[model samples]
Target: MTDTALVVGGTRFIGRHTVSDLLANGYDVGMLNRGNHENPFADDGRVTHIEGDRTDERDLRAAKLSTEPDVVIDCVAYHPRDVETAVDVFGDVDGYVYVSSGSSYAEEAIPKREGETPLRPCTPEQATDESGETYGNRKAEGDRVAFAAAEAGVNAMAVRPCVVYGPHDYTERLDYWIDRVLTHDRVVVPGDGQNLWHRAYVEDVASALRTVAERGEPGAAYNVGDRRALTLAETVETVAEAAGTECEAVPASADALAAGGLDPDDFPLYREYPHLLDTCALAALGWESTPVDEAMARTVADHRESDRDGNEWDPGRDAEERVLGVKETL
Candidate 1:
């Protein structure tokens, strides 16, 4: 009587964690992907690998026939057409969850809610464009596609996550901060150190996907994040605490950052405006997020075990040091 689940992109980041969560919850899992990345669950008896390209409809159809999944978690649909194709292919599944983003919200609200917030409108050009500039538009359109599919009797849902971070996070966004806390005694923080950016732990997002698939209302979108959104300063402190270290968070103003020949955006996880999401809807599905402290601890442990210094995200210590010196004189 075990439920069968198929993850479209199961070898990386959020998709990777989703596969693990489903398996732990007594579901037989199958992964359909291009097999470009190494499969962590390759040898596991409970997991199956269905090699295919998600962008190819023939491949998706083949995977559906091979797995006969009760639920489908799509992690790689980037365009509206992708969702349209998926809905056509897996419309018969018990639940079809599309991975959406908080960026899909059109307006700047304190806390973006699922139904109340306005979703960005996607133009025909944006729908087909593969650039990051049109990502929000594309995601919003994908959500609309899912809703339309649900209206047609497909159990399609969407889960929007802002800034997801944890083990195997290829984005390396949070890894930059973890690297700073581990290597530097003084970490340069933007503005008042209270810049808030809601982030979801990878495991929490994974669980949210499953929960939404199981108990979520058809055509509804759910936001996922830690119940307690941490400020930039608090996040640094948490990372330091989790790493068992003492590091000072040095606050830098816009002028100070410019003096150092850098901008606020140069710092990873720093946002000019607060970007928050209301996860109460997801929580109502009997899902809970991991405590920030516990999440940071696991992230730090994974960072310590890897070689990701997040240098791509770092503007350079010399520049940050100049900013610190400017702050000291101020």
Candidate 2:
């Protein structure tokens, strides 16, 4: 018998990729979303779209999610309440995979492993806050809640991924670098560009989520990313190479960026410390990541073929110009 899977928030990014993976794997898929975004898979006959708000208990019940699907993958659960509601509403399933983030790990370690580094906790106030500043804390709390549901016989697991990059990335994090290298003569990188960064290909992350859903231990959390970490400068150079461009990396210190009216948070890959994730647990479960260079090539190609000109990073461009101006003076 074919398995049936439901993907919550299946209209974009990782959710879209996961839906494709499920379909390719021969499983009937159901998508739950607000019906605002357009997904390429909506036309597939084997896929069903359930229109509803995840936060509304009434909407979730209306979707009949408690009918006991073979697998359920939640790609947008940010708060503990979301997880609680999912478990309460879905009741029981063969497998449950919650898409968490590596940011949920504490800042103490360099390469965060699944069980080594402790997870940060969020208070009730922080969990419900509208501001996204508490994103990591809230994700950590949500991970705990998912595992708690697993303990209560929900057969759930959490997949914590680092920076995810590939085609159709609405966030424009990786696109910032791609557009810069393809269009500009020089790319201004913050803080010497030596901090190690970990990122996973969108499709690879989707496959890992499906793998965890099918074979991962219930009540466990897995860190998913490339086995190797690349420096920011190296990452930029790789993108430039993929785009067939040669943009010079203009290294600017944190103080210089601040002086140039650039907030450190504005740069997507600018972290003071290395943000690497250990993916051995997921690898042990038979998931492999796409190489960095190969992934960059695909991303650059996607941008070239798609209508991404409107997706320019204006703040990043302004900051780069300011830093370049200061460098010219020196």
Q: Pick the candidate with the highest lDDT.
A: 1
* Candidate 2 per-residue C-alpha lDDT over 125-211 given as tens digits, one digit per residue, 9 for 90 to 100: 999976778999999998898888888888889999898888888877777777778888887888888867788889899999999
The whole-model lDDT of each prediction reads: 0.95, 0.83
Misplaced by over 4 Å in model 2 are 64-68, 255-265, 309-313, 316-322, 325-330
Clashing pairs in 1: none
Q: lDDT of candidate 2 vs native?
A: 0.83
TM-score of 1: 0.99
**Backbone-clash count (model 1):** 0
> Would you give me the overall lDDT of model 1?
0.95
- Global Cα RMSD, each model: 0.7, 2.2
